[model samples]
Target: MITRHFIDVPRTDGSARRVHYRRCGQGQPLLMIHQSPRSSAEYAAVMQAWGAHFTCIAPDTPGFGQSEPLAGTPDINDFADALIDLMDALGLERCPAYGFHSGGIILVTALKRHPQRFTGMAVGGYAIWTPAEMAIFGESYLPPFQPSAYGEHLTWLWNRMLEQSWFFPWFDVRGEARLPGAHADVARVDQAVREMLESGDAYRAGYGAVLRAPRDIPAADAVVPPVLISAYFGDPLQAHIDRLGPLPAGWQAQKVDTPADHHQASLDWLLALPPVPAAGLVETPHEGFAHVVSAGFDGLVHWRGAVGETATVPAPGGAISLITGAGIDPPGHGLSDDWPAAAPTDRTVWDAVFAEVQRLRGFAGFDFEPITAGDPHHLYPDLTPDRFGSHLTRAWSVVRAGAFFRPRHQPSAANAIAFDSTAIAPDRLAAKHLALLQARSARAYHAAYGRTDGP
Candidate 1:
């Protein structure tokens, strides 16, 4: 089973930075790094595939996922050091690592700086961008991506990611820049766009560092771990193997026919290497969240304050706490997991579920106040994606309305909420926007709650 975790790593400035990661399988430890604008979620399938031979550990790079962003503008070396920091925090003295695309760049940089920290590396693609190519990318590749008042950014985001699969550099549209496997897959594009939305403006930092990084490999004489660099036939970086002037004695680079072939080759190479014992792999305790698995439910429940202490669930457009002695996001809400199938329409089921959650958390009881929406249908808009991405605007409208009215769907004087400029600020609205996106089953959960009032 795959499990999520958080670890607090102390910084030089006496601050603690929390990192979120996914861990699965059990064997020798294998550290996996994902590409830019993506979280460790990208490696889910790969982790499952390699789980039999290695305990796969994949983490979101700083600023890109639930992981906190680095202070100020950080370069590629800072990213490399950040990876080392995570490894140190996890008590991993050394481990075999794997990376792809920009992930490979960070791993390569880490190997150069701290060769002893890794036994070996299997990099899917090592980019060696030419000066002319960098010049073109520098001008138009990465623009500042910030949320707009009306969600105009979503349109551009969808197109940018969609076309990325169509062209190298993504911004280049000429005949020569077109990729052989250009596609218009909506599901694929939607996933990529959602990841970008999750990263927000932080994408510029992580991706920019990759573009500005030095492309040279370590010197032939330098002592380092064995590295295997490979790219598939259709990959744009496949041509870069020629650009790699010379590799260290034990390093090798090659091209494969397909992604499957590349994965098999990487797996074969890593399996041949001497295995490192994964002893003393430590995981920090859950600080700000709790995991609950009860009858008909299994998911994470985020909470604040000490167990058994006064907990508060803040209500929308109201300052009062609805439930006391633990603020928990119910299944299918906030960061909690979605219901596996259709949500149970029975109130007794929900009551038993919450009871189990309370018991697991060691809470004696919870004080509940009835929370209702006047028009439940309109309260949660249909966020289904359309060709033009109009759902984004609809979601933004609901989020903005939430700040001004008691029942976000109704905006009369009776429902008027106190005007607070801070609440409507773009950053605040953007946060709520992200929360809405992440709450995949909010509509179903709300409907289930409403079904308790059967005719």
Candidate 2:
């Protein structure tokens, strides 16, 4: 089965980048890089197809999916560095790779900078734009992706994704550049839209870097790893093949008729090469982190500092390992990646998180009672409808803000000291929690559906 995982990798600057990836099959590693505005989720279908032959590791490139983006306006090479950092952290000395579009750009950059790190590469549609074309796209292809309080951006986003297939430069409709493949598929559009939502403004940062990046086509004299560049007929950049005048010794370019043909060609090329064993996942000894196969969520669930090592929470038949804290990316905290758009409720999320904890740690049940700042109970009441607002408020807040960065439902005990808990007496904590929750609800309302009135 295809499995999801997260590994904390420190960049060259010493900041940690929690890289999230999907892995399956077993053999030599084949690192898969995805195009921007999408996650490694793009390779879900392809991973299964190629998993039997190779241990396919596809990561949500920084700032796109679960993995965090680079700090500030980073260069495209920074992304290449992130890839190297991930490889080093995962213990992958050298591996073959396949990249598509912007993914191809990233891998090519990495290959140029460090040729010994990769055995070979098979890339689909590497963009080779002229100076003027680069300028046009760099300025307008991707805009600032921040969320508007009224969600006015949604209108543009939906249309932009849908119309992208119809037009080369989506903004241009000058008749000559209209694409024959331009058509709408709800499922396809929805998938991209949800990813874009998870990405938010970070899309511009990642994608913009690609547009601004300089290409380094290997010289014929330079000894480099083999590379295959394939562009399907319908691909927008198919013509760029001619633009690539000369290639290195082992480099070859092909113009394929269809995506399936292109994919098969790439697959065959990879299988033809020698396999290099990838770094396997390390086992957690006692109290640490592990990627558990949860029904809905797939990422790391940490069991450090939750409870004692030998201690088990009382349960029905046996006992459950105490596991707490959400994952560390968008939506929640600990180490999970992006939250889905359909979006589950607080109860469902906790239940799913804990269930994975129980199953992975070989426990029958769990006794997880988190008393933290953003605990769902603060927004949602179990029995009596408490003064705190409904869970919908927080969910909507997260949806609108494009993230739940600072969940304002309930403050920790330290905050009580911060807000003068003793002076306000008995009702102080309760009042403060309710006030914060309601205030957050109003902001969510404004951001989600443009409701400006305070709760």
Badly placed stretches (over 4 Å) of model 1 are: 279-281, 284-291, 302-305, 312-326, 363-370, 411-416, 448-455
Clashes of each: 2, 9
Q: Choose the strongest candidate by lDDT.
A: 1
**How accurate locally, in lDDT, is each candidate?**
0.77, 0.65
Candidate 2's C-alpha lDDT?
0.65
- Best candidate, TM-score-wise? 1
* lDDT (10s digit) by residue, model 2, range 1-455: 66776677866676666667888778888999999889988898999999889999998998987678889999988989889988888888999999999999999999999899999999999888988887778678887765444345556776788888888888777797788787677667756765786677888888988888886578877799999999988798899999887899989999999999999999999988777875687322333445655546655544432332222321110112112332211122322332333334444554565555655555443332222233344333332221221332333343322122223343344333232324234232222222232231221212222211211
For candidate 2, which ten residues in a row score worst on lDDT?
Answer: 313-322
